[model samples]
Target: MSNRGAGGLLGRRPPEEETGLPKDEIFDLMSNHRRRYTIHHCKQADGPVSLSDLAEQVAAWEKDKSISELGSAERKTVYTSLQQTHLPRLERAGIVTYENGEVELTNQTERLDIYLDIVPENSIPWGVYYLGLSFLSCLVVVGLWMDVLPTGAVPTLVYPTIIIAAFTVSAAYHALANRRYRFENLDEPL
Candidate 1:
């Protein structure tokens, strides 16, 4: 017999190819709170979970009340959020399959490993980076206006230019610091 090795038939290919789920789709699937929780619960569950059961669990966790006790208003809100926002996205991602009244984790053993690795606990905030850049830019502009440095020694614009260069260096450092941890969905491999 040819040695297929440890993965058997399932682990033969890299995890990405085996799942047929794209990296972006997987990231989107796990980004949200409810969907993430649902996947986590399903992973631990013994078998397929019905929609009602899943809803009941979510409702209890979110509202601290039974699904039945939720009034029409609350029910409408939850139903809309689930049907419109959560289920469609999860279904499309191939992480969860919806059938009849139940949703089941499809090919759980094959996909779980990929899902865990792709979805990280934290992400670099692009907003923070841009904001810092803006703040530094502003500081440099003010320094130039104030004539804080010796004139003719360096052009007025040169001060800001040096600051800009420093900012670029720091930004590059930040990007590199978090580069390994970046989600594959957000950035292409360098």
Candidate 2:
């Protein structure tokens, strides 16, 4: 592992192989809501964005409104927060560079994305979902063993095979969805 930061009781910082982040720092930077929104907007933009534009977008996201529909207060609230707090935090973390009233993503910005995820309120985590699928697979296998489930037309292992295949496909789909927030692919279609 790369020792990019001084090691202590906390252990060596995580290597920068892909995420360009120490594992601990990623969480710290992502802890605030505004910073998360700042990085999200930076990734979504096609190029460097003015501070005012970024704040407007973030305010729009928070209000679930279009830019033109946003009240001055809404935009100003986000703008002040970003200018005085969030942008500086992100810059210090090397996730973005804000200068002269404009902000742009750095290579580290892409890595920051790994720390942010938006999940629906009603949804179980993917790991739990996969575990549930595995449990169902095992139950099917046991049902076959006990002959409680009819395996008359197909092989005894067929039901379990289908269940495992379903899990594999679902996991792959979710993996791709996780990458949907990546900076490099932001301009690409989902």
Candidate 3:
């Protein structure tokens, strides 16, 4: 039998594999500004935040950082870093919870702590998965063209259709999941 204890508020097993390291790792990873913003928003006592709020805060931060004039490229870099790098890792660690229209923290302290051990080295580039599907779909289509597979047994259009549908749905799900823990503004003193 697994080592996971029985179900209780905090005793329940994490949705993913458990690591032996202490939970401080989560906070350590949060040492960075982008990662810290995500954690503070989700785990903060105030409450959950919306994606629009997050986007707005990011925009405001960009403006505030300008000495005289703001660089669009710099602002874009921050935004991209938050959305592509920090948030995805936090989501994978299960520190943030996503739902209908808001993001909140999952109150599993033990699990949350355990998640700290596995710092997300990089955001999972979902676009790569879509691209892979596209390439595979093309290959399957080519096979059909060469008559490698029996005609009518498998529809020529089915592969690409499935790839498109799967990628679309998965991307949507990931977006929603990441958005769950987003806080509107983190510039305010916490």
Candidate 4:
């Protein structure tokens, strides 16, 4: 075989072609706090969201206040930003459709979830947690291999079995935690 291209033997294709948007542009779109809030609100919305209403929600979140308590200045700043800049950018990216003073997420928006991993505040990053787990597992295996730690009547089989069980349980918990961050479950707190 002379070649093994990204899209099979046919040939390599750009990520933009495959995912409908380039990874760089996707990252660029997510770079702004307001844009991120817009996407999050749109995902939680049942259907098309009015620009003014969306701006209110975003302003409230940004100010850490209830919608009813939002000042006109806070709402106006977010509303103008969304109307003039954020929505048009998102519309061009095909992640959302903006029309008739309303906004709705498009199919292309689904492709973005992979980039939008929402790690809650004060929580350990999953990568760091998994790395620590793997390291601890290795130490256990090494300890047994060198006889530095005693099993104390526990069978040799039980050591690796415990390790496997730990991994299995951790993986299951990780999966469930991830699902909670998804858009469909936005009704729950992050």
Most accurate candidate by lDDT = 4
**Per lDDT, what order, best first?**
4, 2, 1, 3
lDDT for model 4, on a 0 to 1 scale?
0.85
lDDT of 3 by residue, 36-83 (tens): 555554555467776445544555554565323546665566657766
TM-score for candidate 1: 0.46
Which residue pairs show collisions in model 3? Answer: 103-180, 103-181
Comparing 2 and 3 by TM-score, which wins? Answer: 2
Q: Is candidate 1 or candidate 2 better by TM-score?
A: 2
**Counted clashes in each candidate structure:** 0, 0, 2, 0
RMSD in Å for all candidates: 12.6, 5.6, 16.1, 3.6
Scored by TM-score, the top model is 4
Ranking by TM-score: 4, 2, 1, 3
**Worst ten in a row by lDDT for model 1:** 181-190
- lDDT of candidate 4 over 1-190, digit per residue (tens): 7567666456766658766887798889989888888889988888999999999998988888899999999999999999999999999989889999999999877778877867777999888998998999999999999998777787888888988998899899999999987744664222
What is the overall TM-score of model 2 with all chains considered together? 0.71
Comparing candidate 1 with candidate 3, which one achieves the higher lDDT? Answer: 1
C-alpha lDDT values of all predictions: 0.64, 0.76, 0.55, 0.85
- How much does candidate 3 score in TM-score? 0.36
Who is ahead in TM-score, 1 or 3?
1
